[model samples]
Target: MARSGKDTDKRIKTGRGRTASQIRWLERQLNDPYVKQAKADRYRSRAAYKLIELDEKFGLLQNASRVVDLGIAPGGWAQVVRKKRPKAGIVGIDLLEVEPIEGVTILQMDFMDDAAPDALTEALDGPPDLVLSDMAANTVGHKQTDHLRTMGLVETAVDFAVQTLEPGGAFVAKVLAGGTDNELLKLLKANFTSVKHAKPPASRKGSSEWYVVAKGFKGRD
Candidate 1:
C-alpha cells in the first residue's frame, strides 16, 4: 500500500510546553471544514465521510439492499448506510452497545469470535448485498501491536464475508497503512473481482488507517 500525508494545518501559535504533534492534530481538526460540516449535519464522527466517499466512488449500495455492519460502535458508518438507502436492511453488531435506530437492528456482540458470523447470518432473512466493517483497535501506542491487532480484525471479517456474501457482493474494512499480513492479501486477491486499498478523504490526515474494498466476490461457499 502507498503512504500519503496531507499538508499539516496550523503552525505553533500557543500552548508553549505542549507537544507540537498533539497541538497540530487538534488544530487541523478544528480548522477542517468537513469537521464543522459533520457536526452541523449531526454525524456521529467525521469518519462517516469515508463511507460517503466510498459510496460516491463505487456505487456500493442499491435500493432495498441487505447489509451487515461489524464494529458498529457510535453508529457513524451505519448511519451513512441508512441515509443512502433509506429502504435498505441493516444489521449491525459491535462489542460496544449502540443506541437503536428505527431502521437498523443492532446486536451487541464481539464479532472477532468464531460464532459471530453465524449470529449475524441468523439475523438475516436472506444473503447480504454488502458487508461493511469499520473496526479498528484503539492504539496501545505500540506500532507493531496495533498493526497486528487491526490486521486480525480485517482477516476475520474477510473470512466471514467469504461465507456469507452473495455473489457480486462487496466487502469493505479498515486497515492501517503498514504491516498488513501478505497471506491475507493473497486470499483477498483470489476471491475478489478487484481488491483496492484506498484512503477516503474523510479519514483524518494523521490517521494511520485506510480502507480496503474487495468487490465482486465469486462465493467460495
Candidate 2:
C-alpha cells in the first residue's frame, strides 16, 4: 500500500518495465499530503481538495442548486460537490468512465459532441447555478499545440455556461499558466459581472494550471 505523508521520503527500487518518469510520479504521489487526506476522507482523488480549496475561497457551492461538471473522470470534483451540497442536482460528463456516485448522474460521452449540451440540460430540473469544467485536451507534447487544444475546451465550456447558466450563476474552469487568453477574457467579462483567476493551493506549485472564476451571469439577452 502507498502512504501519502511528507514525514519521510519514500523511494522505490528501479523495477523492470518501470520508466524513470513513472517512478518519479509514484514517489510524488506517495509524498502528497492531499492524497493521504483524500484517502482518509474517502474522497475520490487528490483533485477533490482542489475543489474544496476553491470552494472555501470562492463559495462556489454555497447557493448552487444545479451543477454541471465537465471532465468528471475519477469523480473527484463531483464528490466534493456532493459532500458540500447534498441536495444540489449534479450532472457530469467525460470521455472516461466514472464509478457510480450516489447522487450524481454520470454521462460517458464526449462533451464536444453536439448532443452533449442538450443531454446535460435535460438531466437537470432547471438551469444550473454552477457550471464547473476541469477539462483539458490530451497533450501532444508540443507546447503551443497543447495550449491551443486545452483552450479550445475551455472556450466550449464558457459557451455552455453562458448559454445555460441561471442569472447569478457562476462558472469555474481550469486554464493554463497564463490564464485565459484575451478574447476569452473579454467574452467572460462581457457576460459576467465578476471574472478573476486563481491557482488553488492544492494544485502543485510546478503545475501550470490556474482557474478562471466568472460569477453573476448577465443572461443571454
- Alpha-carbon TM-score of each model against the true structure: 0.85, 0.96
Q: Give the Cα RMSD of candidate 2.
A: 2.4
Q: For each candidate, what is the lDDT?
A: 0.83, 0.93
In angstroms, give how far residue 135 of model 2 lies from its true place.
0.6
Model 2 per-residue lDDT at 63: 96
- Tens digits of per-residue lDDT, candidate 1, 159-197, equal 888888888899999999863468988888888898888
Tens-digit lDDT string for candidate 2 (116-185): 9999999987899999999999999898999999999999999999999999999999999899999999
Clash count for candidate 1 is 0
lDDT of 2: 0.93
Top of the candidates by TM-score: 2
Task: For candidate 2, report its TM-score.
Answer: 0.96
lDDT of 2 at 43: 87
Instruction: Give the per-residue Cα lDDT of candidate 2 at 157.
Output: 99
